[model samples]
Target chain A: MPAALHALKDFSDIHINLVGNQALIEAELASKSFDKNRLSITHAEQVVDMDELPSKALRNKRQSSMRLAVNLVKDDVAQACVSAGNTGALMAISKFVLKTIPGIDRPAICTSMPTMKGHVHVLDLGANVGSEGESLAQFAVMGSVLAKAIDGNPKPRIGLLNIGEEEIKGHQRIKDANSLLKLIDINYIGYVEGDDIYKGNVDVVSCDGFDGNIALKASEGVAKMIGFYLKAAFNRNLFTKFIGLLSYPVLKAFKEKVDPRRYNGASFLGLRKIVIKSHGGADAFSFFHAIAEARLEVQKNVPALIAQEVATLLTPQVIEATHNEI
Target chain B: MPAALHALKDFSDIHINLVGNQALIEAELASKSFDKNRLSITHAEQVVDMDELPSKALRNKRQSSMRLAVNLVKDDVAQACVSAGNTGALMAISKFVLKTIPGIDRPAICTSMPTMKGHVHVLDLGANVGSEGESLAQFAVMGSVLAKAIDGNPKPRIGLLNIGEEEIKGHQRIKDANSLLKLIDINYIGYVEGDDIYKGNVDVVSCDGFDGNIALKASEGVAKMIGFYLKAAFNRNLFTKFIGLLSYPVLKAFKEKVDPRRYNGASFLGLRKIVIKSHGGADAFSFFHAIAEARLEVQKNVPALIAQEVATLLTPQVIEATHNEI
Candidate 1:
């Protein structure tokens, strides 16, 4: 509630519809000052628990805050929806309410990750486990569109994530997806290895949810491990500790540069409406960044652009040619 | 050659047979001081190119240095074989010459990675891509034996790498592997996410080559990215540059703590003989560490232990039970 209120204060052009128990929200917002005209509350009778199954939530929690937020988007009362609720439930409710774009088979979880030069968008961070060639191709297109919408890159270099750069490497589905992507109008680069994700050469990387999820989580693990090592190194002895104090400002700047809060929102692309999933443990600052991400997606009209791109790129002939090649 | 000569000087109990051209080996070793009796040379006329396909190398390079080195291991002239040549060719030729332990489907690439407590062993780093339930179970057993041999942990905690820890979360093959692992005699700790690889709670992490390869490479990418960011942060201004100098010793200590050279060798587990693959671009120190890893494996007789474990754990009843459950 505070994050939304803070965002409302920061972004003058945007309005927020906070969906939850109205009385509880009002109590939380009692002390915070904001433009009441720009901030409204939509009372939701229920709330989705973090561990609740997606199917059960979809079946039973129709009036849940998550569901109401999606309803607001569907009814045009809201241009976008941002949630820090259960990922599975949010995905289920949003997919049910907003539906997918005409040609997209499934919505992918896309987020930007820090890289050498800037950052690159990666998709299917655990939406589906074993994606086929056609579904992977669709992820490529969606990721490309989102990259274009967000980064303003007219031709984002799209790379298929694989174990090796050679055409002969990886699974058959990757090969099929490679052929399909090559036929698309987008700037489809050839295969990229795992290290290429941080190289910043490729603007977008597409892979199955299994691989994407593993890569993202593995990167997180490495970051945490490094942090653990860095702390231990700084506290080794009196001299090291004193040096750590002198290096504090430089370390602070580095931390700010790679802060995860700045990249808080993960958009569910290929949907009819913009839906952003913030990290569940986000604080007010991080949540505000997610809201800001939602505002950007809404302003860019990402879904419409994706719809147009997918409709053109996934024509009958392209699908047929891809199948034949596979 | 210098690394090998250095190892000969350090480890008084071991001798080395340099397998490349005699003239070239002698020329490189001319200035190096080592015990003459501890070093010998075997001349080979051919060399395996780094980019050569594994199949082509196996078929055409019969007298290559890689083949001769493996032959020395097969003939018991050397207790272990370590090569800094092409990974694929080394694996292929080693598998051809040494074959596999009975009941083991394939030889897996196993290596130790830096972790929170100390380090953990991860297997199938690129030996086979799409491993089935049976193969994954075999990998778990082989990894378990290798961990025991190296870490001296009688019953090492074994984890199957998955996208999530929930039984219902990954692909069907993972579920099948889970059931099979549960039935195995080793300390099966169930599914672990990518971050668990560095947590150090699990002694060995087993996965199909694709996931393992991606996880490892993704880790490398993150490490490189952090290093890049750290350098940028220090070079921002004169004051920060001064601080970087003050923190140099601390940073150097941290680097040594997580140095890649300290964990250089990747053992080819499940082979009848010990084979270690050093990084193709390894420096003298890194290559020496690889040699040290091979020496450890030889001292522990890892292959014999793995073969004995497989023979005991993979009995007919166990296979039948696994097949029925799958």
Candidate 2:
């Protein structure tokens, strides 16, 4: 609430709708200062438990904060919605209420990753499990459209994440997807191994949700381990601790550069309306980043752009031509 | 050549058989110092390209240096073999020459990863691509055996890598493998996510080669990205540069803690004989780590231990009983 109120104060042109349980939110809101006309709270009857199954959430919790939040977008009261709720539940409710873009088969969970060059967006980060060639092809189109729309990259390099870069490597599904990618309208880089995601040469890296999720989580884990190691080393002894104190500003700057909060929001790509999923464990700063991302999504109109691109690219004729070229 | 020669000197009690093209190696070795008795050279007719297909190496490069090195182990002239050559060719040739442990299905690339508590061993790190439930189950058993033999952990906490911790989560294969893991005679922790690998809660994390390879490489990429970010931050201005210099010792200590070299030396586990794989890009310190790993393998007799475990664990009756339990 503090971070959102702070950010909302700065984003004077943008208004906020605090949608959640009414009594709980009103009690919390009483102590906060805001532009009365700019911010308002809406009542929600229920909360989505972090561990609740998506099916249960979808079936029973129709008036959940998650669902109500999405409903705001659907009802044209909001351009976008951001939540640090359960992913499966958020995905289910968002898909159920907002629906997917016309040509999009299934939505993909994409987030920005800080890389050596600058950054790259990776998609299907555990959104569509067991992606086949067609869905993967859709993911590519959605990712390409996203890169073009959000980053303003006219010709973004899109790569398929795989075990090995060789066409002969990986499983049948990826191989089929590879052939399809080669014949696509986008600048499809053949195939990228894991390191390529951080190399920052490509604009978007797409993979099966399972692989993408593992890679994303593994990267986070490794970064966390590095931080832990650095802290331990800095506090080892008096001399090191002195050095650490002297270098505190530089260390803080470095930490800020790689903080996960900067890349906090993940787009639920393929949704007809913009919906962002924040990390479940996000703090005030991170959640503000999520809000900033939602603001970016509305500014960019990423979903509408994807729908426009997919209309031309996802036709039966175009798919057939791609197959014939392969 | 310099790195090898430098590392060779430090490994005084351990002998190294340098196998490569006769003239090139001879010219390179002339200036390097070593304990003459502990170092020897063997000429091989061919070298494996980094891109050479494993099949081509196996069929046509019979006298390749890679083959010659493995042959030394087969002929009992060496206790173990260490190669920083092409992984596929090394795996193919080693499997052909030494074969697998009696009850082992295939050899897996197992390596230790630095974690919060200490380090944990992860297996099928690009060795067994697209593994089935049975193969994954076997990988668990092999990993369990490795921890007991190599680390002297009486019972290791072995976990199957998955997108989520719930048994009801992940794909069918992982779910099937989980049931099998439970029935087996090892400390099989239920599904562990990517972050769990670094939490140091589990001693062994087993995954399909595709996911395992991605997780491994993604971790490396993230670490590299962090280093890049740190360097970029430290070099941003004069004040930051001064701080970086003052903190040099502590920074160096931090670097050493997570240095890739310290975690080098992946074991080609499941082979009948011990075969260690140095990273293809390994330097003196890293290659030496691989040599140290080989020494440890010889001391622990990892393959023999795994064979014994598999003997009791993989009998038809036992497998059938496990299937029945599942």
Candidate 3:
């Protein structure tokens, strides 16, 4: 908490409102044991418990902390809303309040995870489940926009996550989306396997929310597992521990790169305004990171750029990419 | 090359008769530096190139290395066949030579990967792309048999990899498989997600080859990336490199634990005889691991056990698990 506060303190001009019970908020502040002169903490609705899913949490939208945070964006009180709350509820409230950006039928939750080469962003991680081909195409466009906003790579290469690199492979929906992406001339790089996600063959990976969510979490689980085993190996004995000391700097650096806190939030792409959905289990430091990401998206004007580009592509919506005849 | 040769020394009794051009074999042998005692190099038909996909390579079956390997398995010259070559070609040839075990429609390839808690074995990673409900049920039965064979568990808990943990949430095929699995005495734990692959929620995960392959490789990619960054971080500078020394033992231990070689081959389940399909890019160590796993499976008599146990449940081979429900 102190580290998060310190990091946020360096950038004091950024507005932040703390939403929850007065007692919990005060408890968090009092425990900090440091002066809070530079921080802006305002009261909003109480947060819904993390245990609750979006379907159930959204029922109390009027008083939910997530609803209140998203409402801030809706009311223009904040340029972008950031939260480490129920992602599903956050998506619902943001869609209801802020509305989808022009030309985007559904919003995508785009999150970043560590890749072998560097950081890569995947979209529709869990925003909408059971997605169709058109929705996947929308995710590709939105992910490309987010990648450019975060990484500054214009015309980012897009890869449809599939079983194989061939166009004929994958589920029916993926095949349809592949054909569509190819005809659009949007730097489509054909299909990529699951391994490509870590290899960084493409800048943006797009998939349905369910599969994307599974992939992201699975990757995290695998990384953490590897880290655990590495520590065990280092701690094997006195001699191994001595070797561990020698390898400490490299391991720490690797952990830092793989840490999710560095890239904390998944922007709810297609929203009229930037709406970043932080992981529900995130702590103060993670929330701080989410706010930082939100600041970047706001400054980059990602939503406007995406709206402009996708609109041009959709005017004719050239379905010729299928090339079924060829 | 020396390390591989030393490892091969442990299995010196095994003789590899390379029935190909003697001069070419000798030249290739010189390049690999494989110990002559462990393998008797000979000359015979050509081997299949690993680079080509099965659809094209399977056309000329007689000359393919994969076909030759399968013939060796059938002729009792080798206890098992391992191939890092094209998966489809290997499967096609193995099916033709070994044939499917009774009550099994087709063979499925199963492999284990490191996870947060331990390791997970998922089947049909890429053998059969479009599996039906009954096929998946067979996979579930076969996967459990294979898992028990290697893990030594009495009844390995089996799971269906789907979008959700709920039985009814997945596609129709899964819904049908769920019902069938529920009726059996096997420890069917219902559905699992991609994340569960590493969470250690289930011992055996069964899915269509397409999704399974994508998920498996994606996890591998993430692990490799983490290992890469950790190395870089340790090598940052003199001071951090000192810390890197401290962490080296643990990190290396983790890498070893998670190394794919430790779980090299994916068993061709549902086949009449045990056949392990090694990764196309597998090194000598990985090939050796595949041999080890195949030996374990053979000793366990997994095919006979599965044939006996599932005979009744499948005898009335319910067309669909859904029918069992009605």
Candidate 4:
């Protein structure tokens, strides 16, 4: 509640509809000073637990805070919605309330990753586990559109994530998707290995949710492991600890440069409405970034842009040709 | 050649047969001091290029250095073989020359990755692209045996890499493999996500070649990205540069703790004979580590151990039941 109020104070142009227990939200907000006109509370009767199954939440919790937030978007009461709730439940509720955009088979979870040059957007972090070649092509198109809409890259270079760069490598589905992407109107670059994600040469990378989830989690694992090792190395002895203290400025600079909080929002692309899924454990600073991301998507009108692009590119002939080629 | 000679100098018990042009080997070795009794040269009429197709190398390059090295192992002239050549060609040649162990479906590329605790062995790095449930079960068995033989862990916790920890998540093949692994005699833990790879909770992780390759390369990518950011941060200004200089010893300690060169070799497990593949761009130090890895495998008799375990656990009823369940 404090994070949301903090975000409300920072973004002067936007209004927030905090959906939960009105009394509890009022109690939390009593000490904080903010513009009363810029914030509203919608009383929701239920809340989704972090570990609750998506199906059970969807069926049982019709008045959930997550559901009410998505309903606000659906009813045009809000331009966008950002949640730091259970990912599965949020995805289920958002998909159910907002539905998918025209010509998109499903919504993909897309997020920006820090890269050497700047940052790159990757999709299908863990939405649908085993997507077909056509679904992969859809992910590529959606990722490309989101990249262009958010980054203002007129022609963002798109790459298919694969085991190898060789055309002969990877599964048959990947090869089929590669063929389909080449036929599409988007700027589809050839295959890219996992290492290429951080090189920043490609603006967007698309893959099955299974592979994408693994890649993202593996990257997180490595980052955390490195952090752990750095701490251990610095705390080895008094001399090293003194050196670490002296080097604090440089380390701080590096941490700020690659801070995950700065890149907190993950857009649910291919949906009819703009929805951002913040990291579940986000603090006020990180949650503020997620709200900023939502405001950006609202300004850009990302869903309308994606709908326009998909209508123009996904012709029946092109889809048939890709399926036939596979 | 120098790296090989350096390794020969370090390990007094191992003999190395320099398989290539004998005249060129002698020219490279003339300036280096090494014991004469520990080194021999075998002239090969052909060489495998870095980009050469594995099939072409196997079909045409009968007298290639890679082939000769594997042949020496097959003939018992050498206990184990190590090569810093093309991965595909090396796997193809090694499998062709040594063949698969009984009850082992295919050979997997297995390597150790640095973790928070120490390191964990991960298999199917890039040997096969799309593996079935049975093949994944086979990989688990082989990886478990290699971990036990090398790490001396009586019961290594084996994890199957998947998108989620839920029983119903991930591809059918993965779920099928999970069921089969539970029926096997190894220490079969439930599904683990990608971040678990570096958590040091599991001793071995088994996945298909495609997912494994992506996870490994993504890890390399993150490490390199972090290193690049650290360099950039330290070089930002004159004051930071001075601090970086003062912190050199601490930084070096962290780098050595997670040095890729220290974890150079990838074993071709399930092969009839032990084969180690070094990174193609390896320097003398890194290549020496690869040689040391091969020596360790030879000492542990990895292949024979894998064969024995596979024979004991992979009963016909278990295989048939897994296939039927899938």
In order, what DockQ does each candidate have? 0.66, 0.63, 0.47, 0.70
Question: In candidate 2, how many Å is residue A310 off?
Answer: 1.1
Q: What value of lDDT does candidate 2 attain over all alpha carbons?
A: 0.85
Instruction: Please give each candidate's TM-score.
Output: 0.98, 0.96, 0.87, 0.98
Runs in model 1 with CA error above 4 Å?
A165-168, B165-168
Quote the lDDT for B220 in model 4.
95
Q: Candidates' interface RMSDs, in order?
A: 1.9, 2.0, 3.5, 1.7
- Give the per-residue lDDT of model 2 (tens digit) for B202-304: 9999898888989998898899989998887889899889988888888898998888898899999889898888888888889878888898888888888
Query: What lDDT does each candidate get?
Result: 0.90, 0.85, 0.73, 0.89
Alpha carbon lDDT at A228, candidate 1:
88
lDDT of 4 by residue, B74-182 (tens): 9999999999998999889999999999998899999999999989999899888778888888999988998898888999999999976242388888888999999
Pick the winner on DockQ between candidates 1 and 3: 1
Per-residue lDDT of candidate 1, residues B61-119 (tens digit): 99999999999999999999999898888989999999999999899999999998898
Model 3, total clashes: 37
* Pick by TM-score: 1 or 3, better one: 1
- Tens digits of per-residue lDDT for model 4 on A100-219? 988888888999999999999999889887787888888888888888878999999999999762323888888888999999889998899999999989999998888899999999
TM-score winner between candidates 1 and 2: 1
Residue A11 lDDT (model 3) = 70
Ranking by DockQ: 4, 1, 2, 3
Error of 4 at B14 (Å): 0.5
Q: Residue by residue across A40-67, what tens digits does model 2's lDDT show?
A: 7889989999999888889999888899
Clash pairs for candidate 4: none
lDDT of 3 at B236: 72
